[model samples]
Target: GIYLPVGLEKAAYNDGRTPIWNAEGCTTADIVYDDLRTTNGWDSSYKIDFSDPCAQKYIDSQARMFADWGYDFLKLDGVGPGSFKSGDNYDNVADVAAWQKAIATAGRPIHLELSWSLDYGHVEDWKKYSNGWRIDTDVECYCNTLVGWENSVDDRWDDAPAWTDHAGPGGWNDLDSLNVGNGEMDGLTNAERQSYATLWAIAKSPLYTGDDLTRLDSYGLSLLTNREVIAINQSSAPPAEPVTASDPQQVWAAKNPDGTYTVALFNLADAPASVTADWSTLGFQGKASVRDVWNREKLGTYRDRITQALPAHGSRLFTVTSHGTDLEWTGYEAEAGTLSGNASTAGCSACSDGRKVGNLYGGGKLTLDNVVVHKAGTYQVKVSYISGDARSALVSANDGGATSHKFASTGDWGTVNVVHVPVKLKAGANTITIDSGSDGYAPDIDRIDVQK
Candidate 1:
């Protein structure tokens, strides 16, 4: 629904032309219970065991194809919970690992969202492998209809902790596609939709539109394009915790990095509602300008309090910035240093350590030897590389710590191969290391630039 015209065809060639099919070749079948069988509630037909190397290989290939097609976000469905297989079952875990390997090898930045719920303990483990995973059964439509004296409902959106903690930057706990523009009776009202949007934005959930975008009306379009309100959700900083739901009609606030706060006001009553927050509760003691992100209007400056008239089931969002100020450049870098694959001169210069031999493949020990910074700020890091051998390399930032991001060069590197990491800096004292694990042919490191 995000307008991904790029489908499976182009993904097979790594052509950057369309959305890669995230779920490829994985089998699926309806669940059937057999009472005559000795086995309890288990059914053999619904099993999907991916630990088998053959199955893993197939999944890996599909993931590679998606990466090649420029599809970086994946939702691996039909592989967990109700979809479990019999003995030797490593379906979810193995598939995730395989996809991670595939994405790394392809040199692409991918966000994987897994279907079905995982064990609570596996949260950190999954985060280490993929960007995000779903923690519940598919989210159904929000509205429900009644038949006779009984209500027949098919969709619901309930929050659970099992998948919540796993959410943040580079990773998220998906709650499924948003039902914003859907006019179905089970669909939420305008205010309710606003609440849902505000919550998802604050949660940093993947912004997938469940409604048919082509048929969106003016109101739906306005909700989707409210840049001010949307910016809070798109803030670079990880999402903040929601203030406690003390009152059903009230929403709370949290502080962000740039002296700004993300504010949400909810309306739970049956009709229209209004609420206000004092500056003291938001941790601000001085005057601040309030900008309504939804309507994109300047609400003037307030020294102590702010008020809003939220329609029933509706809410408002604001990015309260200190009044009277210019845009501040957080950080900047001039040279990302030289990159090379030769281990002997790895410490000398960037290119001396690696070389670009071909568009699809390179032969050498890949290394980002030196990086110089001209300004200080938080920087997002990216590196490109290529390797044919099944070798994994360690990407270390500021020298080796217990943990560092790892990359594997797939057979091709001409595609948009990359990995991302955020680094904080002072004037200019940062170094990155690329240690190629004992592969016969060294990997290749291309350009390295810091994004402000």
Candidate 2:
């Protein structure tokens, strides 16, 4: 989506970009006035009275024009129905609805995203008409450098959790641009950069790179491409929440559907300190193995708790899984299977073996060659997969008839879910296959667990 202002309001009064106000058919009836005129820090500006038919028609035309130009996403900034304390007095619900109607009329799947500290009171309306909405002020410092800590980035930590329930598959809480892909010019320290990326990823905010790609530094590039960290961002899981609301030293955690947890420890103080992740707070029991997501290193197994000495403003991400003494199920990792067509393996820090099979659709398939079972009978096999939208897959055993299973949204691509499928198996080694049928794409498979 291209970033474009709503044009209903301007940075400065009478800055000379008032198409809706100057249209031939439009009159004073289309403009909104009163205390809201200069209350928004602008000396003078005009607000579009969306209630007026002329104003609605004018916005409709603009939306249709943008859609016709092949824009699949639209970031409509400076929208209203916000807080009056922030100088937004008029409602823009009709305006947003007008754009929604216009896009549907144009027959395009353009994503309408509202921006600039949108009102939480009208959240349902925002969700109804848009794919995402900005929950806070801009993260940009608007200085010689891109951004600074005190300006707005830190504000998201407080503002984000308030809107967690509001974010999901189709709609999300946008935290503005992620400006950590460039060094020096990013106006952040190395530790700050990692913290910035970690928070945005775990919060499920859109990871829009707000930096110069051509001048990316090695550290910045690594932060942007870390597959393990990106998995947390892409997961269909909800935003991670503060474990104990402690300042200077904070811990956040999110439980994954496949009985795993993504944990982050932060030292937000000016000096180095110890940050700890408590298993009780994370809702886990027994000894568990931890993997450092950023460094991609297994940190060994621990019981009850794990602590790390972090540099000030530094953060750490880890995926924790319990190792219980049970023989109820046997695991088969997808990445170990034969990938055919477009099917391939990708690093998933949260999955077993740190990899999973993906792109299984349109001739893509995964074949597990030696899926041995003790007896020739029906076994409940748990398919662990990730998906952000509705999908289906075909699973078969020993070249038998395939069983089609429909999967519902798991929230995003990072979160994992398990579905049980009854597969008739032989007493010895048997083969299992997974692929998309004659329908839509298949979910990325993490692994399958056969009931023992």
Listed in order, each prediction's TM-score against the native is 0.54, 0.64
lDDT per residue as tens, model 2, 1-452 = 56565535444334433445325765443544433343221222356555557666666666777777888989877676552334444456766787888777765788888877887767789999888898888899999889987688777766665566678888888999999987688999899899999999888888888899999999999999998898899987887766534356777778887878888888878789998776655544458899999999999999867889999788999998977433356799999899888899998876777889998888789999888878897665777787666577888999699877655445467666665555789998999999875445988999987755
Clashes of 1: 21
Candidate 2, run of 10 with poorest lDDT: 35-44
- The alpha-carbon root-mean-square deviation between model 2 and the true structure, to one decimal in Å, is 17.1
Q: Say which candidate scores most in lDDT.
A: 2
Give the number of the best model, judged by TM-score: 2
Worst lDDT 10-window in candidate 1: 146-155
Prediction-by-prediction clash tally = 21, 7
Give model 1 RMSD, 1 decimal: 18.2
For candidate 2, what is the lDDT?
A: 0.75
- Per residue, candidate 1 scores C-alpha lDDT tens digits across 185-293 of 2255666667767767776767767566777767767777777657776777556443322233454565788877777676656678777654544533457888887
TM-score result, candidate 1: 0.54
